[model samples]
Target chain A: MAESKWTPKEPMVSAKDVHKSFGDLEVLKGVSMDVMKGDCVCVIGPSGSGKSTYIRCINALNPIDSGSIEVEGQEVNDPHLDKLELRKKVGMVFQQYNLFPHKTALENIMMAPMRVLKEPKDEVETRARELIKKVRLEGKEDSFPGELSGGQQQRVAIARSLAMRPDVMLFDEVTAALDPETVKEVLVTIRDLAEEGMTCILVTHEMGFAREVANHIYFTDRGVIVEHGPPKTFFTKAKDPRTKEFLSQIL
Target chain B: MSARTLIPGITARATTDLPVLKPFKGKPYGHDEIGFSRFLANLSPWAVVCVVMLLALWPMAAMAQAKYTIGDAFDALWKWVPFLVTKGFALNILISVTTMAIGTAAGVLLGLWQISPHPAIQKTAWAVTQAFRNSPWLVLLFIVMLAFPFEITIAGVTIPIPDWMKAVFGLSLPIMANISEVVRGAIQSVPTGQWEASESLAFSRNQTLWRIILPQCFKRMIPPWMNWYAILTMATPLVSLLGVEEIVTLSRQAMEGENNHPELLIPFYGFCLVIFFAYCYPIARWTISLERKFSVKL
Candidate 1:
């Protein structure tokens, strides 16, 4: 496939025919996608379709069996690739809202910047407070993860990822574990981030949220990207039978 | 007793006050009776053990000739009480504390190595932990006491290793192995999500362990660590077998000093049991409380 004629800036994240496996099971077979700067890309797939694995490969969290993933033009699969450096630029929020349970909401957001980046405490605290408010957890700065609702914890997790000042954000079904009522609050937070032009690749089951927020949509099935296009066209006029079947069941 | 008096919480006065019923009359057999029985029921196991020992020793004391009475054994015990506690038991406490400190430090490292990404380090640590964890503590104590040189020379300077110190070193080997299991279990108890979250935040593995993983494991490790300390304290008597002059050895010497009367055996040895039980029982209770307090909610 030729490069898109319209993307003026270089793709911030690019996966070229990425192949990954876990022992006997092949999770990702020649998967590829380009996430441009400030674009919201949604990857919607069935449970075993390797959507999470693909994004995890992008951040070097899981190395690919065979293929290339580059973030900001640095080869992620390189043996000598400084994963810490790659992760600094690419932030991920887990589906479980993996907030540090022992830490307060504010401290959770402040931790990476203060510890990993060695940022000054006062500066990190000030920014952390702002991010807490950005996620609309204003009065819960001191609340530990166990005390917070699932939505509140998920929002704090997003704020934690944002604390690193990352170039790209990866959301691995961040709202999947939330109560129905609380899911909107987390979605609104993500929508606000997208509107502010943060580069994002979300692997989600929330198709309605995807169509509303994502500029591009990729439908994965059976370890491959079966169809992808602009969300408007991709949702309505999916060409692949597998994509149509998946959309029919979920929608 | 009147039917009304038999009803719970009704006093004899509240029932019918009759001279014939006066014998059975007082407070109802409610709270006070339950309280007395509960007191007996809740009696410390240590106290029960002491009572049983006294009861069991009484017959032997009675069977002894008129030459040395049970009262004579008491007098001998009273004479040596201060020396036995201050010198002998103090060594036991010292050895336990020192062995625990050394074991904990070494065990934590071994535990970390057991989970190291490197196969060689992980295997070696696992083998070392298994080797010491399964070996009998007494056997290890004997090996260290007998095999280790009494002193060593380094840099033209000689440092003498005391017998008690050697006993401490021996005791620490098993303690280290057991503590290593404790540390490994504690670390593994923390969810994998923590590692992934820390990784995404760009924390190095070392940073993740010290900053994220270890702090959580610390609370989980404490109760078990204290439990091990209690076990170590009880096992300190094994050092007396090596003739390191701990409580048991001192008690034997004290009996000898009292002309080795056969009646001296009960008081001297029984005192050692009581002292050890006194020291370890509270720790066992505290460890249980700590375990409850620190148990992970999820």
Candidate 2:
């Protein structure tokens, strides 16, 4: 394969020694990682392992205590940073989907582009319809989030994020809430996006999907990265005992 | 054949005396034995009103010393009906509508302030809400009526602040506070994920609140808002204490104009009750239906 000879481009998203705490509990302890453009990095870990926290920091959702996170050369941790601009570039899909309950699926996809980006209505509608098709939610455009199934809602959420035309996508356990049967559908949608060369960081528990779709896999334990490598080496020959124990339990 | 003969262990006296198990009669133990009382118990609201009017006026009609009978009092009420409705009840509705408008507008802002990120703004909003919410509506009305000037001159232009207007401002204070709570509750009831989701989408706080948060809250707020309007309309009669000339005050004046007969009290007050009930009952029912309709499944 040409994978071995391929060189990484400049990092599109970089986090250095990120530290964050919630009151007395520290969630991320000096965590750091980098993603080149179009790199699919899957972060896998047990519950409360800071995998979600680290990715959330990239989009400025959870403010870090003592670290620097930059996206596209913009300082995310800076107090004066334009968070709106930062978030526009970094789209995030949460576990619960969180699509607006009042709006239909189409309106949910159209909202951010029209309201935040102030895009033309007709143009946004056209693109939004295309996103709906991309997420395989074509006929469900008029359905509200409450009316759709969990997997379908998650896909619509993905489409909603894509409406803003973000440079990078963050998936924080997007499939964790789905039924076992529906998990595959969502995973397939996400895998297609990753294969299409979207710069993506996924904090997930689906180890098999992570192994199959991600180029690099990061294993975090106790608020820090225990081990990380390309999917083949990382999954088969993990060096750290902690990573081995976690992989053994989940797999 | 006696039960004693049919069964092996039976006593003929006990079996025969066991009040022949007749077909199930009305209520057990003769609780509703009187047909008239049963009819009274089952009366609808309008039926009850009719029965009450008859019972109350029957004695007055039979009073030997009474010069003006119940019929005369009702005739006087009929004479004053047009005036009471147009001038008095209209003002009540007007005050309620105006107060609701002002209260809702101010309350929404106050409610948003309660959830503001700044501690100072949030605390101040909370303090104001608690203060007004805990205060008596009547006391607030009195304070507003007594404290505000009837008219004020601004840059040599005189603007008259009428008494009813003051009443509206007074009534709106408590309504504002309560509506503020409604708004705050509705906004908070929306899952936090919504805020995070909007934030992740790069929506500004104002944009998220106006476009996303408020639209959802609007539906939830309606039932309670209509509830407050009903309560406020009922309380509009309180303004009559300060002589704002609403239905109650007008009814009293109509009685005085009709020689102030003692018999006039029931018919006049009953008219007020019927009109207010007629107006507010539908709103209360509608509020309940709306509450059911807008209830979020989640």
Candidate 3:
């Protein structure tokens, strides 16, 4: 609870005693984690685990029923850091791709930059096109989400998030909806992102991806994190029995 | 479980020709107890009965048709369609378009409101939508006309907004009612994951509603909305009560000879049919195309 004098650069995102409940159901029970400036954290857990809710709290997507979340050194519980600001800093991609179906891939990338960010047209267009190229979706800029395959749409989603030049990116099972063979294309895009040091927190079942891309990996169970450590130690020899059980089940 | 639809390249792969195709190969029509065969067998008598009913209803249909003549209807349509480009048919068009625009905007807002996180907003929206949906549109028109005769004022021109205005207002309220529910239903129909994703992006409630929710709802809306427009067009005659000098009113004048002679009824309405169909056919076809396009997307 003590604030350090130097502030420690206010880890890109920090949550403390974050509790969120919907009706009588408790989704996250006092979750707290610190994500450094450019660290990649992969969250692994079973279906009902709070991985998704935890990240959403950081962006103020799903309000933390009772908790404090901070992004870029500012407290999120206040009315000041509205969704638009948090979203600008913490962009997210969905497991189902969630690309706007009616918009072209280029427009999807350009919209937030133009509308929410209020960036000028030419600059946004250029940056959006560059983002499309980053995700290996250069030629498919004008194509709608429905026109693209599942993997392509997911990549487009990734491009859309990246278009805003966010300080952090959130991925909720980015490739889970993709065909088996198409999964690698999306993972490859994320890998390229991780290599460039874009701060990322991923909720994924892909153990190989976690082991490869994440600097730190956290395994959660029943709304609580059972293990947290560097990927090698956590994936190979987590101290908790739950993590081992999960690894076994997933493997 | 056993009966299959004979649809080939879709439900059936083998049954190419209908004549030799066995009945069991067809798809299930409905009802678990009675498969397509039994259902068809049961429907045979109904079909015969309906044919007889259709024969019986022919006279009524003929009588309805006899109310309007083509010549009188044409005279009515020609007089109105071109006469008052700003005040007559065009005014109806403007009024309908304006009413629909306002109603659609309000309805969409109401629809989104019905799903708001706040209990008060949602409940209030639900009640309003239900009331609008339940209240007769004609009653609404009459009520607006009657209720506003003393209240609404404009630039010191207190010309008690006529029944025509009431008709437009009344009709629009119901349209707004239906549109709001339609908007809400369509928004609800979308996957919950959309809200989750929008939340993750941290779009405000308004942004999420406009960007994520409403655009997705448009596909679901196209069909019902088009149907509403077509039905609204049919109900345009109802506006004549407000004395809007609409097409039907023109038809009545032409039919009655405006010479004070009570003319025959058949030619009177017959003229109406041609005018209505001529205007409505293209819109109906457009709606059909839009429905097909959206259906494919869904």
How does each model score on TM-score? 0.88, 0.87, 0.74
Tens digit per residue, CA lDDT, model 1, B1-298: 4545654686654444554434555664221312322333344876757684776478465766666777778898999999999999999999999999999999999999999999999999999999999999999999999999999999989999999999999999999998898889889888999999999999999999999999888887877788788778978999988989988999999999999887778778878878887777777777666666665463
Off by over 4 Å in 2: A1-8, B1-44, B47-65, B296-298
| DockQ-superior candidate, 1 or 2 | 2
Q: How should the candidates be ordered by DockQ, best one leading?
A: 2, 1, 3
Which one wins by TM-score: 1 or 2? 1
What is candidate 3's CAPRI-style docking category based on DockQ?
acceptable
Tens-digit lDDT track for model 3 on A1-251? 32324254668778888888888989888877889987999999999898888876777767777778888776778765555666777888887888777789998888777777688999999998888888888789889888999999999888888877888898988878889999999999998888888889999989998898899998888787778999878877777888888888878
**How high is the lDDT of residue B247 in model 2?**
96
Q: On a 0 to 100 scale, what is the lDDT of residue A106 in model 3?
A: 95
Off by over 4 Å in 3: A1-10, A79-81, B1-122, B150-162, B189-208, B211-216, B239-282
DockQ of each: 0.56, 0.58, 0.46
lDDT per residue (tens digit) for residues A1-251 in model 1: 22224333788888899999999999999998998999999999899899998988888889888889878788888898888988998999999988888889999999999999999999999999999989999999998999999999999999999999998999998988989999999999999999999999999999889999999999898899999999889989988889889999989
The iRMS of model 1 comes to 1.0
Best by TM-score: 1
Q: Model 1: which docking level applies?
A: medium
* Candidate 3 residue-wise lDDT, B206-254, digit = tens: 7777887778877767766766665676677777776668766665655
Instruction: Write the number of the candidate with greater TM-score, choosing between 1 and 3.
Output: 1
